[model samples]
Target: MQLIRAFLVALMLCAPAAARDLDGIRQSGQLIVCANKNAMPISGIGDRPGFQMEIAQEIAKELGVRLSVEWIWAGYQARYTDCDLMLGVARDPKPASFLRYLQALTDVQVILVFAGPPRDVAFEDLSDKVVAVPSASLAHFKLLEIGADPRVAYKSEVAILQAIESGELDAGVVSSVALDWYRHDRPGAALFALSTDILDVTSHYPLTIALRHTDALDEADYHEIAAKMRDDGRLQAILARYGQTLSAEFDNPYARVPDEISEPDSVSVRKDIVEELEDLARRNREELEQSAK
Candidate 1:
């Protein structure tokens, strides 16, 4: 009997701890989120709490709970932290089996950015242009596949944008999230994002929140919250504050939205080498309209 007792204790010790469900979270009066301390404009501990924090705050408000953040330094550190929510999680075709994804908050796509006036630049047109792409990125590989011979010279989105702004390169392809933050930081700069409507790349994905699979919240529950936020314009307002927006595919649920775009398993360049945190300022409406001009 002692041996059996010892075995049972060992089993209990090895088992993972149970996460607090919705009711438990409400009872605790706090919605805990794991956020990166250095991923600025997304999550951080600077003057601006970052959009991820802002969105998580709204979620906590919806749940009628206060917000509690546990800051980590990188994405890999999330595994070591205990939290109820993770924001800005990229939606994958083959999602992690242990987690349940909420309705996506916004779409992130590869965009072609350059200085000067905006003009429609087709994917085919980039064949002869000198462009800076993040090293070994989906856009980098695509440029090579199309014989563009893009300069794989930059390690971060900010570097690529800086090169373009200085006229060192004709243009650069970066994730839309980077473009949004860059434009926000440099509102007076002439740099603009040119539409790459024809680019068939795997760098596009939707950003969503994820929680470990639990009985507390089902997919329908998640979707209802997202739809409510979307219908009430809260979701759009959050992105707008950071100079970001949803892609056409996942922009509005009430509208005739297209199907979700499938993305590769590979990760994109998300972390910036130099993190900048400023007040959450709204980009002018005309500037956004001029981006597509």
Candidate 2:
């Protein structure tokens, strides 16, 4: 035990110090945020850098510093990088061991989407209609419990939406972010995002700004900044450009934080972004089939 303790102590002493806390970061005149290059509508490297980047830029301006991005393929692994900020993190009472949930920025929910005439979809209305949800998902299980008989053939939100648009499916439950991206891609689509008030299971969660567990700034400081942005309409203005929605702060006891601190999954943060577009081309096949029929 003594040998193990000594080895751990030696390693700690040999390791580099934690990245600068808020004061030091401000002194450096730069705030470094870790981002995924391919995660569109959240974080991206293309001409249209995602909303997360835009939000970070606003935050940096508020802090009176320049924003610098360290682009990575996966954002969960940012804990190991020399970055201080990570955007679009799910808010949790207990954040990951390596990070702190700074503040809730936006609302992410599983919305009911369908085409035809624009009208709100009630949960009871789903019983008689065929609906689609990702296989083995909470939404799927809930639909089964309600006797909705949800279809799970579609693997991605985009595919499910396309199926609905092609009249191959009736309705779908998918990420609001995915819905926004879909709408952005198909501006003239008749699809509508209906009720987000799904019961039983949690259909909504808040997206937050996560700060590395460093000395730079405490949770309250970041919270104040977020509150200011929310009050002044800057946050909403930024999200509006990307079709995102702001969420009021709320408590969530059942939600789990990232506990796998040793080796977090590289795919964790990028999964939603990837799944949103996966099998999107399948819609083309559906279109051809519809034409044949």
Candidate 3:
């Protein structure tokens, strides 16, 4: 009887450890999420949490775990592979670097807007005007493809929108989802979506969640689970609470490997870099003031 009792105690002691090893995750009863604090509407730091935060919470609930968010500032790249997951990543299959362990959950659109005569403007007519865009932003690349000449690059979206409001630029590019929120709160600001027929730059931005890449799980496991969530309507319900929906046409694309894989590199902005950008912005502002005068 004493031997049997010892055996049962050993099993009891081993159960939790076995579970932890099987899942290969921290046994803290929480899922750690790394998120971009500046990507508004999707992920951002504010009094009220954004859509990505709410979605991450839902995913954690579905997994029977708690959600723990760690907001990342600009130039912080450690979150790429350090956390259980990272929210608000785009699925670019060409160079799948930094997202090998992630699976896309939904699609988002990029949009263009202009402050003009009416709230209903067309894309073709935008050829004659300069568009304010953020440097190194997806919208900036899209604008370049659409033949927007003399693209005026700004340091941030707020600056771009401010330029548009003050007539510093004829138009601006922003995330379509975020633009919706901005328009809802601010009235009399004429905003129009450029006709997709002329310059269709709608990108399928996949909201993704990351896991350990070296773990012995297949990508199909994640896809199957996500598909079940969608089929059972749980995914839609979750998105509805956050006022978003899945795109009908786009499927999450996957690539077997990335163009490059390396440790997270440091991003340093030299004083001269900032000075040059500031000088350019000042020149643009002065030019706008002169044009207004």
Candidate 4:
């Protein structure tokens, strides 16, 4: 009788453990989050916490899980693969092979910075001056479209701003939110906004959560939740707390380059580029083999 009573007590303890919801995650008890440190207002390493970190914490709280942040360097390719989810990513409906999920939170503005006598200058007037831009960024492509010299390109916004400040570059392009932060911190430096609007005023690319392709979460799930948050003012409240706002409609010139310039048609343009590159590589390899023979 004593043995049977002990067995029953053991089963009761095991049953609750077996039926526990979120066992998969609770076992870990931590949701790993990857963030780009340079993504200002969205994510950055500074005294003030970024908006992305705030939103991510909220999500983790809802999940009843702890948030564990892993900081990635400036380049996107190096650190995207190490985490369960990424914050402040631009939305890509058909993402890269490894990216399974993307849901945008806000659109960011891209603006031009120049040390000038006036508050603004037109884009057409920038033809002759050296315009520094971050490599692989929307600003770089925009500068290229307008025939700006590629030699002036820098790898990060920090470099671009440094070049502009030191008079090495005539102008630099940066996110407006970051610019506001910089201005607030440094009242003496006179950084003026350029009047020349070469591109349409765009929103920051839809900053989203990027997850692995094999993750359980899907786009629909993310969208439904995100849209609800947006609708109920949850997202707005979050942004407002960080001194920012959720974009009403996507229109940040610095975020994603327009479809007209780099169309997202998977079956058409990008496919052709990929194939052409592959063909070129194959031809080069064949030539090397023939030489070896």
Candidate topping TM-score: 1
Q: Whole-model lDDT, candidate 2?
A: 0.70
Mark the regions of model 2 whose C-alpha exceeds 4 Å error after superposition: 1-18, 72-75, 112-173, 184-187, 193-201, 214-217, 250-293
**1-293 per-residue lDDT for model 3 (tens digits):** 68855654543332211112214443577766677776655676677466667666765666677877766754234323245666666554442243344445555555566676556656656667688765655556665765775365464455566677778888777666666556544656665656333455444355555543324454455555567777888767765545566655225454322323211223335434544555655665576578789
Q: What is the C-alpha lDDT of each candidate?
A: 0.67, 0.70, 0.56, 0.59
- The global Cα lDDT (0 to 1) of model 3 is 0.56
lDDT of 1 at 102: 67
Candidate 4 ranges with C-alpha deviation above 4 Å? 1-23, 74-80, 97-102, 116-124, 127-130, 136-169, 180-204, 214-234, 249-258, 261-293
Candidate 1 vs candidate 3, lDDT winner: 1
Residue 30, model 4, lDDT: 72
Tens-place lDDT digits, model 2, residues 43-75: 776676778788889878888999998876645
- Judged by whole-model lDDT over C-alpha atoms, candidate 4 comes out at 0.59
lDDT of 2 at 56: 85
Q: Rank the models by TM-score, top first.
A: 1, 4, 2, 3
lDDT of 4 by residue, 169-255 (tens): 888777665665565555576677652255443434455566553334443454555666677888888776555666654233233
Q: Cα deviation of 170 in candidate 3 (Å)? A: 3.3
Clashing pairs in 1: none
